[model samples]
Target: MNKFIVVTGGTKGIGLAILQKFAQQGFDVATCSRSQKDLDTLKSELEKQHSCNVIVVKADMSKRNDIKVFSDAVIKLNRPVDVLVNNAGYFAQGQICTEPEGTLENTMEANVYSAYYMTRELVSLMKKNKKGHIFNMCSVASIKAYPSGASYGISKFALLGFSKVLREELKKYGIRVTAVMPGATRTASWEKSDLPEDRFMKSEDIADLVYASHALSDKSVVEEIVIRPQLGDI
Candidate 1:
């Protein structure tokens, strides 16, 4: 059976880049997005270009029930999951004092809980096989707090912590976990911004790093990576 890779929020942005990268490498790719139309489009595009199987599902990663349904679908494939990328997240800019109630919770739901629930559901399968690589899409906010980053920063911080914990816990089982922290990536999130493309890192750059990390020998693992543009955070 072909090896499988699962990615969340893969219709566009960094997630889409990772999905395409793996598919190009001939891995059977399973990914999800909230938009069914986008999912269909992506499935068609990838299938047209790659020989590997592309499984696209509609899923709201922020909701636990949706994740359960998505997880069940992936598990049904019965292929060992070679890689899991928790890339479903959003950026909500607001200060804690000024932001309305539930802002923090909502951000946490999308950025933190989504990864937590999805991992909890699929980690056992990885454990059973004693081999897997998990990537948590963290950010520079995880390490340094900035203005208007209260809620989003908090969530990424929690995600970084979770990634670290998973790395330590899964080491004994031969499972590798990595935290990918990229600064100011060029994605839909910045589409409206006037900043030049050179000011931001490319999503494909992050994907290349992920592919390299996964391609490394089984004896070595890149636990954490912080990638920034040449000019630095914008």
Candidate 2:
């Protein structure tokens, strides 16, 4: 049985980069996206390009039912899950004071609840063998407050805190959990930004760190990683 990795929201951005990186290393990948078309395309591309199993499921991570749908897809594979990236998230820039009602609730549902539900379903699989690594895609917003970024920042902060508690609980199980807090990265999310492409880090930069962290010795686990653009937050 080949070791496999699972990633959510893996059709684009940092999630896509991480999926490709793992596939390149000969790991079978199971990932999810909301777009069935994108998932099919990604499955074909990765299988053809990397010569590995590419299981792509259509899932809306914010919903527990949908998370179960994705989890069932992966669990049926019956492969050892070596790494799981809870990368599905939503980003909306809005001030806490003036933002519409349920702004924070919506953001938290996507960024925090989604990861929580997905992990609850999959961690048991990892626990079965007492092995695996889990990465939560946090943000620099988790540690710093910025204007018009309240919902995102608050959700990210809660996510980081969740990762911390998960790490503590899973330590004895030999399942490592890491919080990845990255600064601005060039992705579709920033298509409208006026900043130069060089101003923000590339998705691959964050992907590289994720791969490296998982490659470390089983006895050595990175608890948290914070990376930023050279010029700093934009």
RMSD of each: 0.7, 0.8
Which RMSD does model 1 reach against the true structure? 0.7
lDDT of each: 0.93, 0.92
Once superposed on the true structure, which residue ranges of model 1 sit more than 4 Å away at CA? none
lDDT of 1: 0.93
Candidate 2 TM-score, C-alpha based: 0.98
lDDT of 1 at 135: 99
Query: Model 1 TM-score?
Result: 0.98
Q: What is the C-alpha lDDT profile of model 2 across 30-88, one tens digit per residue?
A: 99988999999999999899979889899898888899999999888777789999999
**lDDT, candidate 1, 174-210, per-residue tens:** 9999999999999998888899888999899999999
lDDT of 2 at 209: 95
